[model samples]
Target: LGGGMTNAVLALAVISWPKYARLARSQALTVRQQPYIEAARLSGCSDTEIIFRHLLPSVLSPLLVMSALDLGTMLMELAGLSFLGLGAQPPAAEWGSMMSSSRSMLQTAPWVILAPGAAIFVTVSLFNLLGDSLRDQLDPKFNPK
Candidate 1:
């Protein structure tokens, strides 16, 4: 069921979308209970305005941060599927598949395996750090200083 980038992307999106949905739902629910929302309602803000102006902003920040964090995980998952021959067929170059195909060379030419592995490591680490930085910057409660 895999040979192209689109297939991998669709698979990952299908698998990961529920997490974001749940997060949005929870954030909305939490924000709904805040005193400011109550005050907005008391001051005659319509439901649509309350949602657009207040709830959306409150919920979107966490979602963006979560999406940033999920990028690395999704990439790893895509690579894993490719390595297992379930994603990104031979024509498509994927780090996991590259490493998988080079497994036999581990003893004779370890660099072949090491190169892709190192790339995956660095890429994943950078994504994770990006997510953390986003969280720190976006979330009001987090103060890195």
Candidate 2:
């Protein structure tokens, strides 16, 4: 509908929402069957209390990891949209736009095209690594033993 950064963000959010929703739903379902949840129920805790005190904490780690991992995907998607002229306006500085604008110079000043491409690669790789490290740090099964 609209163009520019806000539109790009909304598009990314729309694309991302379903995955996180499914993940949260599955995590909550698993947590719901845990002994602590059962104990909380036996202790007469309300659903809201149990959800906030138990389910949320139990599910937050995985969600954090998912969000971290999704960042790179979102960034790439936004960049692709910008490259296609469907995202950030001309005035806005975006790597994809930079690459797109320099496309004609590919045979002349290849660095113009390569620089943004390399930047995108490095940034995405860093974000993926960040997600991996976050998962390692947060997952209980990551014991170095």
Candidate 3:
């Protein structure tokens, strides 16, 4: 179970990082054209120094928002995999496994399946809402008048 979660996180990080890196690079490229960046360069600052010190901070807000959104998605994927028995195995009382095992009883005792399923639904929804809120708050382009 632990290994599965770790692998999921690792995979998500690896897959998501390139997109964030591209956004960061685009932001950095734009920031680099700013007068301050030119001034820094004129003052003998290295490219690495300008990127880390100037450009990175400017793009952190959107990256953080995106990361929060990714977390909820990763959780859903993990739960789906676990439910299929490809993740957590026997003896573990994971929500997915519980839901999976209750599949046969779903017609008789629908609550058994509904309970865990609802929990997963609510948790994922809350995270997604929170991420969207964060994105709205952090993104200058979405600023209210």
Find the candidate with the highest TM-score and give its number.
2
Q: Rate the local accuracy (lDDT) of all candidates.
A: 0.89, 0.89, 0.79
**What does candidate 1's lDDT look like per residue over 1-145, in tens digits?**
4456678788788878998999999999999999999999999999999999999999999999998888898888988888887777777789988988999999999999999889988998999999999998889988765
lDDT for position 91 in model 2: 82
RMSD to truth, every model: 1.5, 1.4, 2.9
TM-score per candidate = 0.92, 0.93, 0.79
Ranking by TM-score: 2, 1, 3
Candidate 2 runs further than 4 Å off: none
Comparison by lDDT, 2 against 3, better one = 2
2 or 3: which has the higher TM-score? Answer: 2
Candidate 3: residue pairs that collide: none
The sequence of per-residue lDDT tens digits that candidate 3 reaches over residues 37-121 is: 8998999999899878877777788778877887778778777877877656647777787888899998899999999889889
lDDT of 2 by residue, 21-119 (tens): 999999999989989899999999999999999999879999999999888988888889989888887788999888888889999999998998899
lDDT of prediction 1:
0.89
